[model samples]
Target: MKTIIKYMLLCLLAVNTVTAQQNSQSINLSNAEVTPYEIELTQNKTTHILFPSSIEYVDLGSSEIIANKVEATSNVLRLKTVKEDISPTNFTVITNDGKYFSFNVSYKGQPIQLSYDLTKFEKQKSKKQSEVLFKDLGSISPSLVDLLMKAIIKKNKKELNIKSKTYGVEAWLKSIYIQDGKLYFHISISNKSNLPYEVDYISFKIKDRRTTKRTTIQEVSLKPIRSYITSQKINSHSKQDTVFMLDQFTLSDKQVLSIEVNEKTGVRSQVLKLRSSEILKLRRVELLKL
Candidate 1:
């Protein structure tokens, strides 16, 4: 029985090895090349290929318009991009095999020599970390907050305080920490108000630049505090204070977080702002934890 079990286990292991090899072969490329912002790959066998979900291609020249075109087949992946209405820039393409391809652009119907180096591109790409932080909130100003509050109140479609909405709130991100590859945003909410109010939910309006669509990325609702006092004075004077903490929040490249508060009484809402250094600090902390 022991001998039979051993033989069966060996057979299973062999089968698993074969399966893994086959799976790897599906995406194997034969000859791969990378230019500064471009990549070309050829496959050894006819296998279905998928384009990369995200890619950043940089142009060396000063051009207002740049476009990228990608094509993938069973055995090849090709990417091409050109600057419009400007002289072409000299650039390099680096291949995965430690090889570089150099190409130059045409300027005024003249060929300009451009030297391409794969190592340089790799260095440039690696120097900049692709991470998002809370410092991004600083761009939210008083005027923008007013506009967003007006929009949200309009969405609610209620007859609320139009005159008492004299107060404004802002958020300053102090620090961001990352642990285990997850992001932790530390922010301080500044409220400029004479009357006390309860904030029900904090809504974040995230804009998708690629699609030009606005979507709410996060809606953090405050845990309601129960009270026995039911008098109007008690309700109106009740001050709500709390810090929000979120775990495992992930950010995509070029994504920004716009925070807004939804109040139960005394004006409708407030907006928060974050900064860039705070974001980088958070990313560094998170990376260290991981």
Candidate 2:
């Protein structure tokens, strides 16, 4: 009887092992295979690939092909062939948005296409899956941050009445959102007159809210890690919305946040102030809902 019991246990274990092996082969293993994009390069000409987000890491399968990020652009990768008609090799690229791309490289005297945009081909993960971050972005994924900004722009809800208007131009504070350990501010600029309103700059600063004017003012400037602006100039009778991402910060009761926008070569400067109470009224972003 003891021998029969042992034999039965062995049989069950064998069956389970066989099932697990089949499941892995049919599902996970098969899904792990990714098709590589095919491209050809030449010795003289260079190929440029534009990504939707910033490029983080790149790996060359062979030394025959050299890749570099284009100057003044974070997401553009320039590829060139080291030897004429070199053997077929491959390369890999990782974007800041947590997307992986593979390419099969070959040599061509004159490739059909020299420029490629991989924006639409990128696969966006769920909010939970998109928690990956880069060094510049801190704790939040840059791609996720961009998505949140798009959602806020789509909603287009004016959450606060903070704004500045002059010379038939206005800048409105639309909404404030917080996620991970960062803050997002949505702003809108409108040109209501017939002339275009060219923007010189927009700045955010924390200043002392003193009762009397002091000879030496205390102010701390805050810079956004990422900013999206539609246009530098607001066309007549049109509005442009922008979003800025900053590191999370808090202020004392005696300090206030100031946002200023200036016109290029013009005197249409506007300033909007927010107290600690107003800054604390930020809404937490729900990435799933977005």
Candidate 3:
């Protein structure tokens, strides 16, 4: 009976050794050594963490805290502790650009800072992406979209002749590009007047082809998802270039697309009417590099 007990003990020791070895091997094999950022949370106030890209997912290690992405914004996360004197916890955030972020959170009566902008940190800048598609981009890689946008700006080709000229200010549609269910509009504004053309705003909308004085005009607005423009002021005898990205769409008959640019605090507004035929003139996106 004593020999049998000794044999059982030896078997158990061997099993424990194997399990420990497996665990050590798994821990050592890593893609990257990601150090978790330490942050303190409190119940009295909320903490905000700003990411470079839209947040895709968030997971908390414990229920001691509540966290969520801020409404009406894609890149800001709001967090707060549930109660006072809670135990420490950890959380993970995955962003649309396929970057992973880890945080170790501890409760503090008063946190030193409430807002953290990760975008400003050089270490937090967007690098290589993981294999994930952005929801807004619809199965398209966010990195690819960014690369294409940069490529378009670098190319800067004036391939289209569509324009609306008035008030000594001319707005031209330099190009229209299509890729991955998106439309890229390259535009240029030339101001020939002696005064600078302060652009108030630009609008792309679909409206009825003909509106009667007695009837209400039906309209639909098309807001761009992103844009690449530094300034809106077109100085006298100068020009400015811009690019806008929007979801691809097709209009029906009796509907015309309008691209309107309004002057700031002025009445010089130019509208370019586009028919379905004109909008169909799309340049397929095929760039080797960004």
Candidate 4:
């Protein structure tokens, strides 16, 4: 009985040792050591890899291998080896903020590993994204309101002054201005009704008002350059000043231009109307550097 118990303990210890070895297959590079950043995966097998941040782009060796982007707290990369001859191939990954990484995908059925090279990934500035207004909203100058007022006064143009109040929020189209082939809308929003109101999104477009509810209306594309509402949320009884930039467009008598604002929560929304008369009365302003 004593001999049997000793043999069983030895067997259990061997199994545990194998399990630990299998789980610790990852290669780490924290100690400034130069090691190969490679992984050996079997053909037709899928492997998941976790990264330090969100990934934006990935380049596989070929289209045959499938690479999927997994959105998580941190970025996850899913890679599969479909073809047999695709072993020993190289791949690259680029994070949304421009962090770069490379790896070798093999079919030798080796264990999983990681490679971290401080010399290669020294943490550089992330590249700017294409979301123009959302990214630049926080950096909007405090003097923007004064500049807009000065421009309106200098031009001496009649203000559209189109305003609306809905769901405890009041919005006004102070004026319209054009600079460098771009149209700018100066807008003011006040939360006077004491209800918590926040701007979710703002959109500018031209539509045929005569169309029926089910009719399809043509939309005009306008990109935003600088906007205040796009950047922050307004609380109850507070005021917000903002501007929108878009391609230069001339409104026709048959079509109407509209700016729609939706609240972050609840059913509160507001629309500012602009017809040919108001759009045609736009003032020309000097282009200020952002």
Candidate 5:
């Protein structure tokens, strides 16, 4: 009887050794390193997680569902999963990440959970600033010819001249210079009207007439000038204006550039054309060199 008992004990030890080896192999297979952002699906549900580098999916069958829910608390991302429901045939869980995971109601008995890591698909940082670039045209100024193109469709030259002579708009060449290895511009506008008016839109157009090709860097939209009366007794006129600033530009020699501003629904606009020499002159003036 003692011999039989000893034999039974030896048999149990052998069984335990085999079970331990199988468990170790299973762990090594499931935890293989995978590429970032790559996904692995098992049983039509995301049972194992892997990145782009992962070679295979690890399956955790229904019996192992209880132990399948795991959390990753790495600095890259914090993840959590919980079992929502469990049945004899299947199991379900919900995962929380940047967004909540969705669940289906149709699979009431065989619900599946999904989770993902986004660190692999993160966008790289950009060095460029958010800006718009206009074309490069040599020194150009607002000409009466260009202004006529922006005039109200039906307004005649007589009416326009009368308006300009009576309530003429003030004009000025603000300045031009270079900054951050690029050119910069600032243009200001003022409203000298007695009545309040609304400006709908503004546009800038550049006409490049240069012997060499020039690269235009940036353009800015200016707000329309609006003004209204503050009081009746004073009967004082109020004025409002807009200012535009351009940056990062390179101009070629002998370029003639035209910058035009137009107001939407208003029969008026301001245009500026400057040549390379004129731009240099303005820069010098700004620097107080001449």
Candidate 6:
């Protein structure tokens, strides 16, 4: 009876091992069929590939027949081939999330696997000129950059005698500058009180003086040009400076653009105001050449 019980246990163990091996083989076959990206291109034709997200980086195995090495728009890549080559080529694109999308360019005839939406592609192309201008502004001096900052502060002081708010921390409106149809604000935050201040985040909104509800107003969001600091932890008796940029557009007299700063502790907030007059004053700044 004991020998029969041992034989039954061995049979069960062998059946389990066989099932596990079969599952492993199925998984391997499925993985073999999955690919990053695959498409065929003609020997002397142009091909464009559109990606889901904006491309952050790109790499090419060789630049022999690639007419345009790696010209990438926000979510589009343009590859042109002039002649056929001996060795194969691999093209890879790194998206914002760091995921790699690779492709192999096999020299073939017509009936390629390339498709794109022309309306969306043209819109992405329009941003190329503005993107180049933003990069050039980074090389300018902060002091010279401060001219725009001073302009914004001066507008606030002249129009409204309102001073900056000070809870445990104090914020000052430094300057407002415009470059290549983009609005930018420079500000300084100081914490001299005993309590430490943790920044929650900064937000921009346009409010209508005639209406009380802010949601009714239409405004495009603004972002920091260079991500120098997002939400810094501010210790007591310390100060820091930051800059922000908004989409280029003019506001009417009835509209007011507000920059709101929220604290993590929910104790206090500083709201900076920019009216049409202030924006117009910034337009006349020397460097802007409005």
For residues 154-187, could you state the per-residue lDDT of candidate 3 as single tens digits? 7887777788898898988877898878999888
Give per-residue lDDT, candidate 2, residue 4.
100
Tens digits of lDDT, candidate 6, 1-290: 99999999999999999999998787656644425445666665667766544566687766644523234346677765566542657676655323355567666656345564333533575321111112434544433444454454444322233235867667766666666555666677778888787788878777775765655756656565432353478788887666666556678898887887788876767888878887666543454321
Instruction: Give the TM-score of each candidate.
Output: 0.28, 0.77, 0.65, 0.46, 0.30, 0.44
**Candidate topping TM-score:** 2
Better of 1 and 3 by lDDT: 3
Per-residue lDDT of candidate 4, residues 165-199 (tens digit): 87678888887887556667878888887777777
Question: Where is the poorest 10-residue window by lDDT in model 2?
Answer: 123-132
Q: Native-vs-model 5 lDDT?
A: 0.35
Clashes of each: 19, 0, 0, 0, 18, 5
lDDT tens digits, residue span 1-290, model 2: 99999999999999999999998887555655556789989999989999866788899999988999999988999999888989999998877667677889989998999999776555443212222457867766666777888888888877788988998988898888888788889899888989988989889999998856645778999998788776788889999999888889998999999999988998887898988888987888884267
State residue 79's C-alpha deviation in candidate 2, in Å. 2.0
C-alpha RMSD of each candidate structure in angstroms: 21.5, 4.8, 6.8, 20.6, 21.9, 20.9
Better of 2 and 5 by lDDT: 2
lDDT of 3: 0.84
Range of the 10 consecutive residues with the lowest summed lDDT in candidate 6: 127-136
Q: Which has the better TM-score: candidate 1, or candidate 2? A: 2
Off by over 4 Å in 5: 1-167, 208-243, 250-254, 282-290
Cα lDDT over the full model 4? 0.65
Off by over 4 Å in 3: 1-36, 43-48, 53-83, 92-100, 109-115, 121-131, 165-169, 190-201, 210-218, 229-240, 251-255, 262-266, 287-289
